[model samples]
Target: MKTREYTFFGGIHPRSYKELSNKYPIEEYLPKSQVIIPLQQHIGAPCTPLVKVNDYVKVGQKIGEANGFVSAPVHSSVSGKVVAIEDRPSSSGKLVKSIVIESDGEFNYDDNIKPNEDINNLKPEEIRYIVREAGIVGMGGATFPTMVKLNPPSDKKIDIVILNGAECEPYLTADHRLMLEKPVDIVHGLLAIMKALGASKGYVGIEDNKQDAIKEIRKACKEYEGVEVAVLKTKYPQGSEKHIIKAITGREVPSGKIPAEIGVVVDNVGTAFAIAEAIKYGKPLIERVVTVTGEGIMTPKNLRVKIGTPFRELIEYCGGFKGTPGKVISGGPMMGIAQYSIDVPVIKGTSGILVLPEDMIALKNPKPCIKCARCVDACPMNLLPLFISAYSLKNDFDKCKEYHAVDCIECGSCSYVCPSKRPLVESIRLAKGEILRKGRK
Candidate 1:
C-alpha cells in the first residue's frame, strides 16, 4: 500500500478506546418514526421556516433555505407529513424553529433528486454550487459551509488541500470507518475539491492508529497522481488544520490567519465523501455516520444516522446505555457538549454520541494550580490556558485576548492533562465568547 509520513508539534496522548466502534462495521440505521430538523444546523444565520404545520414533505426536499452567505439550507431527512413547525431545543442548547415530521414509514424521496453530470466536465462554479445546493458542510463536526471554504478569494492562492482523516478525538471512529469503507469516494471528493479550488495537489492525513483506513486510502491513491496519503503519529488535536498542515507540508498557518492565507486548505474526510456523493449521487447533508460508544453503552457501532434524529433515538438504535448512564455527550469527551437531556436533535456537527456511567461521569472539584505548566506543554496551540481561564473567571476580556483566547480550539487537551481539573477549555470558551461579543460592539 502507498504510504508517507509527516511531523507535527506538541500534543497529548489520550487513551483511544476506538476499538469499541472500530471493530464493528458501519450499520445503516432506518429512519425513526419522528425527525426534528433544526433550522440553525449550520454556522451562520438560522433559516426561516419554509413550511407551516400539516405540510406534506418528501425526503431530499428543502425544508429551510440558507439565511445568509455563511449559512446552509436544511432538508427533510425522511418521507413523512409535517405534524408541527415550532420552536424546539437544538444540540447547541438554543431554541430553534424545527420541522417535526412523523414518518409515514415509506422513506420516499423527491422527484427532483437525481445524479448530476460527470464531475470532469462540470465547471468549477458548478462544483461549488452543487456543494452548496446539496447542503454539504464540514462533517468532521465544524459544520462550516463546504461551498464557502471551497470558494476561496482569488487574491489568496491555495496550493495544497489537506483532507483530515485523523479522527484524533478518543472513542470516535466515524471518519476511521468511513475511510475504510469509502476510500474511493473520499479520493473522488478530494479530486473534486482540488479541481474546484484549482489546487495543485491534495493529501489525506490519517493517524497511524487506523492502519486499515491507511491501507485502504493508500490502495485508492495509486491510480491518481498528485494526490497522496500520509500516515500521521496518532495524537490528540492532530486533526486540527494547523497541525495537519504542519504534518503534511511543514508550513505553519500564521497566527490569527486562515489556512488559505498560508497557501493551504484542509477539509474533513467525511466532508470529502459527502462532496463526492453530492456531485455523483445527488444527495444533500441529510445523513451521516456517527460513532455511538462509551463504557455504559450496550452496542458501540458506527451508524449512518439521519440528520435531526433525536439523540435518544440514535442512542436507542445502538441499544442505549447498558445500565444507568449518568451523562450523555454530543461528541467526543475532549470537545463534546454534555446534555442534561437527550431531547436535542443531531445536526451536521454531531460526530459521536458518548454515554458515561454515573460513577465515571461525576467530575472532581477544581483545585488551585500549582504552576506545574503541564497544560502549556499539552496545548497544541501553545497558549497559556491557566492565565486565560483565570482572566475569564475575572471577566477581563482584554486579558483573555492578550493570552490568545481565540486561538484555543476548545480541544480540551489542557483540561484532560491538567492536575487541578480547572475546566481550561470551558473557561477559555467563555472568554472567547465575551471577546467576540465586545468585538461586535
Candidate 2:
C-alpha cells in the first residue's frame, strides 16, 4: 500500500536527535527498595488516599481513589508496606500528596487482576468502565482522564478516533518503540477506543521518518476493517493532538473547543496499548515505557519503567551522568518540564527523561524582538506570539487575550524559531494563566 504523507501549517522542524535512543529496545527497570506514588499525577482533582501509613499494599492495588469523573485512581507499583503518606515533590514542580511504599522484596500481584472476556463480547459502557477502573489516562503527557474522554458530552458527535503514533518530540522514542514492538496491541487498543466512542473510523497517525513503525502498524491493521495507517510529515509538534487531527482529517478544532467538538477524538499509541492491557489482562496502569536519553548520560536507552521508580534510579541504570548535567527534563526538550532534582518519580505522562550537559545548554541573553515575523510564521496555532508576549510583559493581559493568547498550544514552536532568542512561549504561557485566572473571578 502506498503511504500518503499528511502535514499541517506553521511548524518548525528542529533536530530530532531521536537516534540517540531509538536504537535501544525497551528494557524493564524494577525499583530496588522503595516507590513513591503521587496521588495527583493526572490533570484533574487529586486522588484521595485509600491506604494510610503502615498499611500493606500489593502490586496493582489501588492506593489512591479517583475523587471525580475527571480524575484517575493511583495504584501501587510494588507489593510493599505503605511507610508514609505525605506531601512530596512531583514532576509538575508542585508538592502533592503521595504514598511511600517500602518494597517487601516479594512482588505479589493483586487478586483482582484477571483477564476479561473477549473484546467482541464487551459493550461500549463495559469498555469505558474497564478503562476507568484500570486508571488509564492520556499517556502522551496531557494526563487527562481517559475515561472522561471516552464518554464525551451527549451533544457532541464523535465519528473518528485517531491513534497518535507520531513521536515527533525531539529525543523521545517510547511511542516509536511501542509501535514496532507491540503493534498488534496498539491496534487492538485503538479498536477498543473506537468501540467505546462508537466511532465508525479509526486511523493510526505515525511520522514518515519511522518507516519501520509505519509498516508494523499497517500490518497489524490489515485484519481490522475501517482502520488504516496515516503517515505524517516529520516536524516538531506534529504529534500534537490538534495538529494530528488537522493532518489526518483536515478538521480544524476551533479555539477554546476540543477535538470532540469537531466529531473526532485522539489517543496516544501508549494509551491504546494500556487499554489493551487493561481489557485483556485486567491490569491497571502501573508501568510505562520511558525514553532515558541525552548527551550528558553515559548510556541512553528506552526502558519499560514502573510508575513510582525514581528518575535517579533510571539514570543510574543508564550508566549515570557522563559529564556535568546542566538540565534534567521529564520529557522531550521542546516542551518537557525541567527538574531541579532527580528525586521525582516516573509518572504516567513521563515519555522520556532527557539529560543535557553544560556544553549543549544554550545560555543566550534575551534580546529585543527584531520584528522578523518568524514567530508568526512558526506558530502552529497562528496566534501572534510576539504581540501576546509583549503585552504579557507589560501586564496587559486583556490585550494578550484579544490576541488569542489562550489558543497557544504551548508547543514552543515560536520560541524555537525566534531569531532574538526571546522567551515567546514562556511569556505567552504566563499571559494565558493570568487570563484564565481573571476569568474565574
Candidate 3:
C-alpha cells in the first residue's frame, strides 16, 4: 500500500455519513413480485428488446440487445414472465421503455451462461466479447459501456488501468463493504481489465478514510506483478475519472476529452467485481451491491440487490422510511439524480439510494451572489461556475459555452459550498445541455 496520500485540486469534504451503514454486511435482496428492466441503462444508444411481452425469461438471460457499438446489453435479473412492455419512469426521471417481469419464484439460470477458459488463456478480444455479452457497464453511476472503455482505439496505447474504490460520495458504503468482503475478486477483475487493455500497470485508488479497504486490497495485490493500491485523500468527487487518473498517475485528462486520450482507463470497483463474476462464474450484470442509507431510513443497509428490483422494495426491506421522505435520490446526495418516484427500478448504474427526511431537507431561496469566488475555488474542473450559472439563468448559453460550461463535471461541490444556496450545478447542467444540443445541430 502506498503511504503517501494523493489528491487533486479544488474539492470539498462533506460529511460522509458512512457510519449509517458502513458496518453492515451485504445482504441479498430478492424482489418477490416484479422486476422492471429498462432498455437503456448505459450512456450511448438504447438497446432493443430481445424478449417480447409474455415471454418467459430466465435469470442472467440477455433480454435487451445492444443497438450500437457504444451500447451495452441488458439482462433478466429473475426467472419470470414478461407481464408488461411499456414506458416507465427511470431513476433519471425520464420515461424509458421497460420490460416488467413477474417472478415465478424460481431463479433459473440461463444455459448460455457458462464458465469460460482461464483468465490467463483468454485473449483480449475474447475478454472484451465476454464483458459485452455480460452487459457490464461503469458501476460508478456513469453507466458507460465497459466493453467500449476496455477496447479503446488502437492508436491510443493504454498503459495504466485504475479501479476507483474511492466511494467519495456521502451516505454510500456499498463500494466500501465490497472492497472489504471481496478484495480478491476485485483484484482478479483488475487483472482481467489490464490484460484486455494491454496495460502494464494497474492501481486501485481508495480514499484514506477507508483504511480497512486499502489494507484488504493491498493484500490482494501483493502477488500481482503490476498491481498496487494507491491511497487518496477523502474528498468529494475524488472518485471522478479525471481526478482519480490525475491523483494516481499524475496524468491530467484534457478538457472535452476522455481518459483514453491520455492512455489510461478507469473503472468502478463494483464494475471490476461484476467483470470477475462474469468471466469466472458466467454471471451476467444482473445484480449489484447498493447502500440504502439516510437519517430518514429506519434501517440502513448495504444489500446485494438484483437489477430491475424496484426502489420501493429495497426501502421496505431496509425497514422503510423513518418519516416522510423529503427526497429520495438514486445514487448519492452529490451527483445522484433526484428521483420523482420510488417506482423506478435499479439499473446498471444504481449505486446508492439516499432517503433524506423532511426535517433534514432545507428549502432555501437563492440570494444574490456575494462574489466570494467560493464557487470558482470549489470547482474541480477549474471553470467559473458562478459566471456560467449567471449566463445560463440569463439564457445566454453562448456566453456559458465560452466559459467552458460544458467542461463542468456537475459534481455539486460549488452548490454545496455556496452560502447563497445558488443552483450552481443545476444551471450549469442546463447550460451544458443547451451547448451540446446546439453543437449537435
- TM-score quality measure for candidate 3: 0.99
Model 1 bad stretches (over 4 Å): 1-4
Each prediction's Cα RMSD? Answer: 1.5, 0.8, 1.0
Candidate 1 minimal-lDDT segment of 10 residues = 1-10
Candidate 3 per-residue lDDT, tens place, 212-236, comes to: 9999999999998999999999998
In angstroms, give how far residue 162 of model 3 lies from its true place.
Answer: 0.5
The parts of candidate 2 lying over 4 Å away from their true place are none
Clash totals for all candidate models: 0, 0, 0
Better of 1 and 3 by lDDT: 3
For candidate 2, lDDT tens digit of each residue in 1-441?
865799999999899899999989889888999899999999899999999899999999998999988999999999989999999898999998899999897989999999987789999999999999999999999999999999999999899999998989999999999999999999999999999999999999999899999999999999989999998999888988899999999999988889999999999999999999999999999999999999998999999988989999999999999899999999999999999989999999999999999899999788999999999999888889899999999999999999999999899999989989998889999999999999999
Off by over 4 Å in 3: none
lDDT of 1 by residue, 1-441 (tens): 745566566789999988888978889887668999998887788887787788888888988988878888888989888998889988777788889999888988988778989889889899999899888888888888888898787899888998999999999999998999999999999999999999989999989888889889989998998998888988889998888998889988887788988889899999999899888878888999999999889989899988988888878888878988988888898888888779788889899999988888757799999889999999899899999999999989899999899988888888988998987888999999988889999
True-structure lDDT of candidate 1:
0.88
TM-score of each: 0.97, 0.99, 0.99
Candidate 2 or 1, higher lDDT:
2
